[model samples]
Each structure stands twice: as structure tokens, then as C-alpha cells.
Target: MPTLFSKYAYYFNQLCEFSPNRLQAQKAKNVAPVRYPTPVQKNMNLMVDFKVENKVIGYSLASKQHAHGNCLVHFQSTINRILKPDSFVVPRETVAISICNSFFTLGSSPTDFVKTKQGGKPLPEDSYFTYKMVTKHVMIVLYNSEGAEEQLAGFVYYPQLLTSRRVCPNIDETAMALARITYSSDNGPEMFARFCKKTQRDVIVKIMNGGMSATHMDYNYILLEQNYGSCSECNAFHQEKMKKEKKEKKKSITEKAASKSKSKSEAATATETANSTVTPPPKTAPPKAVDSDDEYDFGN
Candidate 1:
């Protein structure tokens, strides 16, 4: 029989063997470390909150080239959200649903939370969230080729809010009041000013406007999502578009060649007609009469 320590060690090794993060970590060893410049805004020196749940998992830096690709707010959570390679294949939407079920709940299971929309106004069924909620909350966007809109990937929740709810009996009522106020208002600068300070407002605005301008910076990185390269619909559309473009190009070339050939035939015919119409100058009548005029041709 194996010792207790040995058994645990074996289990740990087995888990590491299937760990995606472990593989990434090994890859990182060979790659150079990337450093990001500290961002400063307004009176507040804005920095990524590395402390989550009061535990330091990893440093959160402002990197445009992180794994998630240009995430405005990246929290390096200790937990790995990726599924194991050997585990049964799971759809991304299914994974999103599982995360929702584990972390949040409504009065019931809220199993359809992944498919359901949360907002006051009517919207397309595929929309992930209300525009207002997105402006106010920290959220992640996930997408696949088939979905009409990007799906809700993940969300961060503050444990402090839960603690406050547990301690403060009237927290629900206060929350309801806030919710009513939020719903009544629009997602504008004024609304954001009420909830956030100047720096937060500016950062969120830039993010909502599709990332701040980093063009002036020399070493900025390009961000891309994991599934950015795996869009079947996009691939098919590109194929069809290319085929149409190629056919048009061939048709244009053939038309040009035919036009040139026709022009050459027309030019030959014109040259032949012009040559045939030309008549040599009538031969000059000899000046026989003039020669005799100088002599004794006083003519009778």
C-alpha cells in the first residue's frame, strides 16, 4: 500500500498532466516577460486590483496583448476557467451556463440564465444583456459563428457585496430602490457621474468606445480572442466572396482581350479602304507644244 503522501503526490501529478494553465506556465518559461506601463488618470492613480477575495493570485497589469485580448479590466483569477483536454467536449455556451449556475442563482435554478436577457426594454432575443447593465457592470463578451450576438462570457462579483447583504437586513430594499432609479435613467455621462468618479467614468467610456487610442505608443500589442480564429461562417463567407471576385476578374480580362482583337480588325479594314481610294496624279501632258513655240512655229 502506498503512503498517504505518495497517494496525494500521484493525484497531484495526474491533475497537472491535464492542466492547461500548467502548459501555459511551461511555455511562459521560454518567452520573455512583458511589462506594461502604469496608467494614470484624474486625481486617482488607476491601477489594476490584484487582490481578489483578499488573496493575491497574480499581478493584473494593463496589457493589450493578454490572453483575452484587449480586456479593459482583466482579473487574474487563480481558478482556471478552461476545461481539461481529456474531459468531455463541452460547448462554450454550456460552459457559460455552468458558470452561471455555480456562481449565481435566482429564486429557482435559473438554468436558462445563459439564454435569458436581463433588461427593462424590449430587445432581440439573442442580445446578451441590457445596454444599461453593460455600462454599469464589469462583464465579459463571448462569441461563436452561429450566434447572432456575442454571448455573456463571464462576470465578476464582489464578495463584499454578499457580506454586506448578509449583514444589512435592509440591503435588498436599498438595492431595489437603486435598481428602480437605474432603470428610470439612461446610460449617459450624468448617470455614470452619479455612480463613479471622473477617472472611472473616463476609462469606462474609452472602453465602451472600443478601446483607448494606443496608436502613438510604439510597443503596444494587438489583442485577439481565443475563438477569433475559429469562425466557420466567416470562413464560408470569405470563400464565396473570393470565388465571386475571381470570376469577375476573369470576365473582365476576356472582355478586354475581345475588345483589343475587334479594334485591330477595324483598323486593318480602314487602312485597306484608304489605300484603294488613293489615285496617282494624272500623268502630266507633255509640253510638246511649248518646245515648238520658241522656234519658227508662227503657226498657220
Candidate 2:
């Protein structure tokens, strides 16, 4: 019997040799599509195709590879290398929380059984999304439960799938359901918001309390959030301090000018007083001396 690694190696070889027809034909013969209708898109049924080596062992979805995460791509690229071919596979259980425009599915398979009957009437025009519109984003995370601890299986994200929930007024419940998926765990927009709150609060609290020892902070966790950079209290405090400094500076300048003016006035007043008090030289002293000389000359 070929091991799972051997089978994956064969698949990779097949991928390199790339024949669309051969791959599809092989898949069609070896795999069967299960009738699983996704809640987001009623028209499109979710299909699971399992790989067989003498018997069913592994399952995968034929999904387009994305730069972000995609479970199918990761499963083909990495997960198959680790798991035993004979280990029973199951989907991970996901908690439902309200997240706008997104939803999560446990495992590669869906649990709810929505049936299709033969000769069924066509669904109403409003029952699904139109061909032109796209609405929902999906994140598929896979886990290997065969081990003592559940290990990460693979990661996949689907962006902009059109659904009736997004298009019409009727699928409110569907939209609500997808929104109910928890955003705390995944590193999506919601998780980023959470990160922003945590980091912002920590940084603000530290700075306000005068803890500046941590010069280099891990700010990669920052993306976007409300009241992050523009903290109201911080802004107000700084503004008040700046205003106080400006007022003190102005006061000092005014006081210096007043003192200078007073000193100049006092010097001018002293100069005027000295000039007014100066008496003319005693004019009579010379006349008296001349009179005395004349009297002495007569006597001689």
C-alpha cells in the first residue's frame, strides 16, 4: 500500500505534469461530490472530494490558491505530509459570534444536511445572490484531531462571494449568523482592532504615568482603531501645559520691559536733579579779592 506521503508526491507529480482533463477525469472517477449547500450561497453546493488509494482516506476541496491563507492549498502543500493515511479525519468545532460580513465553517465539511429533490421547482429569483454581486468572505481553518492535541490543519480565506443575504432584504438571518462568528482569535480586521486597543491603552497608561524606559515598542501589532493616536486626555494635558508655558514666558518678558523702563526714568530724574542743584560759581569772591588788593596798595 502506498503511504499518504507517496500519494501526495504522486499528486504533486501530476500537478507538475499539469493536464486539466486528466486531473478532472481522475478526480471525477476517484472522488464524488457530496450535496452540501452552503448557507451563504444556496445555489452553489459545497463539495468534498476524497482521495482514494484502494479506499477513502483523505478529503480535499479544489480551491484556487491565494496569497493569504487557503485550507485546500495548504492541505495539498503541507498537511498531507504529516497525517497518517489511515487516521480518521474530522472538522474542528467553531464558536459562533457576530462578525459583520464573515463566517466560519468547521472542518472541510458542513454539518447541516440540506437536501435537494428531483424535479424540484426553481428557487425564487431573490433566494440567492445575483451573478454580478459579491458579498460574503469565508475563512476556513483545518485542524488534525488525530493527535493528542489538535494541531493546525491548514488556513484558507475566500473573499467576496455573492449571496442573497448581502443582496436582498430577506437573508437577514443568514447575514446575522455569519456575523456571529468570533473575531478575537483570527488576525482579521476585528483582531487587529483588538490589538490596537490593547497596545494603545498600554502605551498611553505607561506614558501618562511617566514610564518611558521602553523606547522601542512592538508597534507592528498596530493597524487602525478609534481613539488610538489621538488620546483626548493626553492631548488636553499637553495643551494645558503648553498654554501655561506661553503665559509664563509672556509675563517674564513684560516684567523685564517694565523694569528697564523704570530704571531709565530713574536715571533721567537723577540727571535733571543734579543739573538743577548746580549753583553758578560764587561771583563775589573775585571782587572781594580785588578790593582787598586795592586797599593794601593805598596803604603802601
lDDT of 2 by residue, 1-300 (tens): 479887677556544433323322322112322223233332123323423222222222223321222222332332244334533332221111111111222232322111122266642332211110112322222221232322122222232122211111111122111222221233232111111233332222113334212111222211211122444454444456557878999999999999999999999999999999998986554534456676677655
lDDT of 2 at 209: 32
lDDT of candidate 1 over 129-232, digit per residue (tens): 32111211111222222345333333322211111211211221122223322332333322211212211111111112222121110100111111112223
Model 2 segments more than 4 A misplaced = 1-228, 284-300
> CA lDDT of each candidate?
0.28, 0.31
Candidate 2 global Cα RMSD: 29.1
* Model 2: colliding residue pairs: 69-156, 70-156, 71-156, 91-107, 97-180, 97-181, 98-179, 98-180, 99-179
Error (Å) of candidate 2 at residue 282 is 2.5
Error of 1 at 94 (Å): 44
| Number of clashes recorded per candidate | 0, 9
Which pairs of residues have clashing backbones in candidate 1? none
User: In model 2, how large is the Cα lDDT of residue 164?
Assistant: 19
